[model samples]
Target: MLIINIHPTETAWSFVDDTASTCSIHHYSKPIPMETIRQESRILYLISPGQNDLQLAPEEQRTVSQQAPHIQTIFRDCLRANPRADHRLLSENRFYQNLPPLSTRYALPADLATRFQRAGRDALTHQWAWIKAKSILPEVKSLISIHLNSAPNAVAIKNGQPVDLSAGFSQMDGLPGFHSCGEIDPSLCLTLSEKGEPPAAIEHLLAAQSGLSSVSPELASFSQIFEQPESLASKVLSHQLKKTIGGMASALNALEAIVFSGEITPALTAWLVDLLEPLTAFGFIPTSTISCESITRLNSPASRIQVFLMEDTPWKIAYEMFSQAQPLQS
Candidate 1:
C-alpha cells in the first residue's frame, strides 16, 4: 500500500514494502510546466481515491495521459501566490525554509522564528516517490485544491475538450489561512507584549491558536465550527466568509464560479449559503432546509458565481503533476 499527502506547499508519500523502514523523501520547487502538458497531451490517469465524498463519473474519474488545459494571464492572478515564506528554500543541509516568514521588524516584530522547512521537503520527497513508483518521469508542477477536491469542470466540455473556466484559480489563502491570523494590528501584539505576554507566546497564539478558534473556546477546529452549524459559531464563520468573498468579488468585478474544497468545505459552503442573511440567502438559495442540506444553487440562476463543494485534492494534485510530466517524457 502507498499513502500520499498533498499540501499547499508540499507533497508526501510512503511505500510500506518494508514496514520497519522509514519513508524516503524528495523535493521540487515548480510544478510540471503548463506548456509541457499542452504539447504532450496524454497521461495515464489515476483512479479516483474519493468514494465517500463527491464521486466523479466513470468518464469523470481521473485519467492517465489525459489532455487537459487552462489559460488566462490576468486570470492567472487568481492562482495562489502565497506568503514569501512559502517560497524560501534552503540549500545548506535543507534548513530554514518553507515556514511563513516572520517579520521581526514589521508592526508585530518578533525576535525569533520556528521554521518548518524540513517538514515541507520531506513531503515533496514522498510525493515524488509515488510518481516514480508508477514509472512516471519529470516532476509534477501546477496544482489546484479546493476543499481538497481537484476535479476539472464537470460542465466544461466543448469541441471534445474541457475548458478551464476558472483558470484553476483560488481565493486569497493565509487571509487568516484556517488557523493563521493573516494580517493583524501590530498594536495588539505590542499591547500583549507590554502586558508581559512573551513575544514568542504571542506569536504562537496568533499563528496556531487564532482565527475561528480565537472567537470561541468550544470550537476545537475550523471543521467543527463549520460542520456543526448551530449557533454563533456558524454565524460568525458565515460573516467572515461573506466579507472575504465580497472583497474578492469587488476586486474581480464579477465572479464566474466559486469552488470550496478541503476537510471543512461541505459544512463551510452549506452553512455560508444557508446563512447568507435572510435576503442574501434567498438570493443564493430560494429553498434551504432546517438541517441546512447541501445546496447546488445558493445564488440566483442569473447570478454568475457558481459554488462547488469537492473533496480529495491530493488526487487532483497528482493529476496536475502527472499531466505536466507527460509532455517531458514524450
Candidate 2:
C-alpha cells in the first residue's frame, strides 16, 4: 500500500508492504510527481490536512454520513461571510471512506486534487493529544488538544472522538495561527472591501500575511515570540492563546487533561509556567519540562488535571492508520 501526505510546506509518501513491516519512504519539499501517483502499482491512500474528501476511519465515516446534510448550508454561510474563504474548510465535511481507492483506474476530482496540493500541513497533533491522555490516564474521558504551530487549532476530545473544534468551518476561525488571521468581524472584511480592497487581496492578507508575523516581522514561528516576550506580538499571542484554551477547557463537562502538541520546543516548555497561570484556576498547574518526540506528562504532581506534551509528527499516525486499514482493504 502507498500512503501519501500532502501539505503546503512539504509532500511525503511511503510504500508499505502487505505485512505492514517495512517499506521505502520518500519526502520532498517539492510537489509530489503526478506521474508517480498515476504509475504506482500499489493501492494508494491520501492523508491531507484540512482536506474534506478524506478516507476517515469507520467511526468518523459514520459520523460524517449522519451529519452530511448540513455541510452545504455551512459552506454557503462561509462563502456569504467571506467571499474569498478557502474551499478546504467549506468542503471538509464530506467523508470519502467508501470511495474508490486511488489508482490508475480511479482518479480524484480535479477540485479535490487541487485542495490536496494546497492544504496547510500540520502534525495532526490532536490525535496524539488523545493518545497521550489515554496512555497516562486510561480513565480519561475528556481533554482538549491545543496545536500552536503554523496553523493553530484546539480540539476537544471525548471518548477518543472530537467533540468540539476551535478551527470551526475553517482553520481561519480558531486561535490566531502563526500566519493565519484567525477570526475577524465580518464587518471588518466588509469595511476593507468598501475601501477599494479586492476581496482576493483581502483574503490573501488575512490568510497569509496576518497573525504573529503581522504583529511583528520577527515573529515567524511560535517559539520566536519568547525571544522578545515584551514585544506587542508576544503579548498579543499570549492573550489569544490563554483566551482560546480557557474557553475550550470550560466547554468540556469533565475535563481531565490538556495536551500541548505541534511544534513543541524548549522555549515553549520553559514558558509553560506563565502560559498556564490563568488555567490554574481550572485545576491545571505547570510542571517541569521534558523535550522529546514521545508523549510526556507536564503537569505538577498535585494538579488534578493531567497536562502533556506530544511532539510526534502526523506522519507516524498516518502510517499506523494505513497499516491497520490494509487488511480491511483486502
Candidate 3:
C-alpha cells in the first residue's frame, strides 16, 4: 500500500493513502486523520512551492498588480482591524516593506501580497504543520521522495532534516507552470539582487506571479480568455496547453512503468490513466490515446525525451480518437 501525499497547489496539500485497497484520499482542509495520528509512519511527503490555485482573470491581474500598494494598505488595515489577532507578528509589515525591493524586475503589486498572506496562512495551518507533525510517525517506513519548484537549498530547514522535494509535474526544468515565467537567464537573479530587490519579492516573481498570469490580461480564469481569444494571449495559451499535456503524459508514463513492472496492480494503473485523461485534455482533445512509443519513451530507464505526441493533432482528429476509447467516467 502506497501513501501518496500530493500538494495540488503550492498552497494546499492533499493526502491519498492507497493502503486500504479502497484508496481514501483527503484534502487538508481539516484535522489530520486518526490513522496519521496513530501510525507514526515516516510518510513520503512532496512539496512544490509557488504553484497557483484556480486561474485568475485579466482584471484581477491588473487590479492585483496596479493596485498592489493599495492592496497592501488594505491588508495592513485588516490586520489593524483585528487588533487582538496576533498583531505582534503581523505588525512588522514585512510583506509591504519588502515589496518594492522585490518587484524591481517583475512589477509585483500589493494585491499579490495580500492574497499570499491569506493563502499562506491558510496553507500553513491546514497543510504544512499537519504534515510536519505526521512526519514523526514511527509507523511510517520510508521518506521516499520530495519535489520542489526552486532549488532544494532554499526550502526552510527544520530540526536539521531536509524536506523531500520535487519541482512538480509542470516544472520539468524548462517547462513553464500555470503561472511561472519558466526558465530565466541565470544572471537574472544576480542582476535583480544587485539592483537591491528584496529576496522575498524575487522569489515571489520567480515562482508565484509569473507564467500564464503574466501573459493573460484576465486574472480570474484562463477559460474566459479562451472563450474570447486575442492573438497574443491566444498564442501563449496554446503553448501553455501543449506544455501541460506533455507534462501530464510524462507523469502518466512514469506511473505506468511502475505499474507494469508489477509495482502496482493493473486496476490502479487503469484508474490513474482514466482519472488524468480529462485533466490533460483541457479542451484541446476530448480524449487521449497513449501509443506504445510514447509509453516506451517515457518509461525507458535511460531515455530522456521531454516531449512526445500522446494523440493525433488537430482537435477534430483527437476528439475522434477519444470517442473510440471507453468513455472516461465522470
Each candidate structure's TM-score, on Cα atoms with residue i matched to residue i, is 0.44, 0.67, 0.29
Candidate of highest lDDT: 2
Per-residue lDDT over 70-169 for candidate 2, one digit per residue giving the tens place of the 0 to 100 score: 3343335333443432223211122211222221111447654433321222324555557656867898888878876677766666776565555533
Q: Report the C-alpha lDDT of model 1 over 225-320, residue by residue, as the tens digit.
A: 667787565556566455545544443344334444444355665665664544343244333432323323345445433444433234333433
Whichever of 1 and 2 has more TM-score, that candidate is: 2
Quantify how close model 2 is to the true structure by its C-alpha RMSD in Å: 12.7
lDDT of 1: 0.35
How many Å off is the CA of 324 in candidate 2? Answer: 5.2
Compared with the true structure, model 1 gives a TM-score of 0.44
* lDDT-better candidate, 1 vs 2: 2
Question: Which candidate has the highest TM-score of all?
Answer: 2
Prediction-by-prediction clash tally = 24, 1, 30
Ranking by lDDT: 2, 1, 3
Error of 2 at 22 (Å): 10
Q: Residue 26's C-alpha lDDT in candidate 1? A: 35
Candidate 3 total steric clashes: 30
